[model samples]
Target: MTSTADSYFVCATPRTGSSLLLGLLESTGVAGRPQAYFREPGEPMWAGRWGLPSTAGYDEYVRAALAAGRTDNGVFGAKLMWGTLDLVVDRLGAVHPGLAGHDVELLERAFGRTRFVYLWRDDVLAQAVSWLRAEQTRLWEADGEAEPGGHAPGYDAAGIEELVERIGEHNAAWERWFASCGVQPHRVRYEDLDADQTGVTRGILAFLGLDLPEGRKIAPSHRRQSDELNAAWIERYSRESARS
Candidate 1:
């Protein structure tokens, strides 16, 4: 079944401040609940939260996700990492008969004329360090979510360098995907959001053709995860990379 809801996606890479963007968007209460709706480890958790049975089919999961995710204003949004885009498309096709066997064509079929927002980080080194630390600690966010327990392992230069290359590759893939699909996404940089959260979010609302009440402002719900540790790792990794 084709959905009539206005939909958009935040096409992102890891450690690109997507969590912060999603929080700011949700704060508007009109931008829809943008999140990693198809991410693993969280998908099953969302299924349980949405009250779906273990044996529920993909269609049922899609319906539940949309029902829970769409805002009252009829806008639905989701954050998609390039890594999981295929899985999302496959599941979407399973539910929407008209969307089968097409790459991005399925997106329009499932969510009528979807818009895309590309969020990326300019500082790849910092992003790589942040991703590595988060993976080690399993603390992807800092919004009072339960601490995953265990100290973050000491940084390894090789690991950070590998992640730097991987992040670059993934980001390049996103670029290629957009180019091949012939879609121009509204671009947002992590640095811009970090500098002015409210202004950036308002700009996004305007891009989406949505209006907010006069004088309305919502602070981001989550804190930036990067800290001195990230800075230190970046310095260490840069030195190692330069030496090698």
Candidate 2:
């Protein structure tokens, strides 16, 4: 029931610029978008979401990914959001009862020599605020309405507190898991990656163990699509976390 990822995996908290990071990795020819369309006949990996490809239909995809790892062509990576991680955790947990308790470790053991980039911002309240904004966007998108261009509304004390606690728990969970594995995961702060493109990108390239191609400009605006509406997301989350 549990299926180990045969290639590299990118496991990180959502809204941490994983998409932008994926774009950068793909640009370097090392990462590929997931074919989440189908898992097997009549079963979709992503269900009806985004028209991603099914696993069974992705035979060449797996081969290409494995080849990319063995050869020096590029770093083969897949972006694993919390949703994907949860799915894998669910499936794997069925196979190994306690796998949920050690999701990161099980993943590392499954994919030997695999690398992970765990991106996080230091401001806890800000992350909460961002999460709120993302939720609003999702609701709007699902309703087939236009995305909100500004903050929806201020958070109540209970809302803010709940958000901070939840995010903090998620952060703490991954931090401890990474430590237990004895794998020094590469970290990228959102602010630093935004402020210093060249340095952050160089660090990322180094973590991926790939040489930076000469004169390739790492663009500054290449992060996940967060708009002005989400500005309060990080701020609120950081503030709430600090208070607690």
Pick by TM-score: which candidate is best?
A: 1
TM-score of 1: 0.91
Q: What's the true lDDT of residue 231 in model 2?
A: 63
Task: Give the Å error, residue 141, model 2.
Answer: 11
lDDT of 2: 0.54
TM per candidate comes to 0.91, 0.63
Best by lDDT: 1
lDDT of 1 by residue, 120-149 (tens): 999988888898888788788876453567
Model 2 per-residue lDDT tens digits across residues 61-171: 334434433324433466554446556545555555656567655554444456767777776666666566566445322223444464455555566567678877777
* CA lDDT of each prediction against the hidden true structure: 0.83, 0.54
The regions of model 1 sitting more than 4 angstroms off are 1-5, 96-98, 144-151
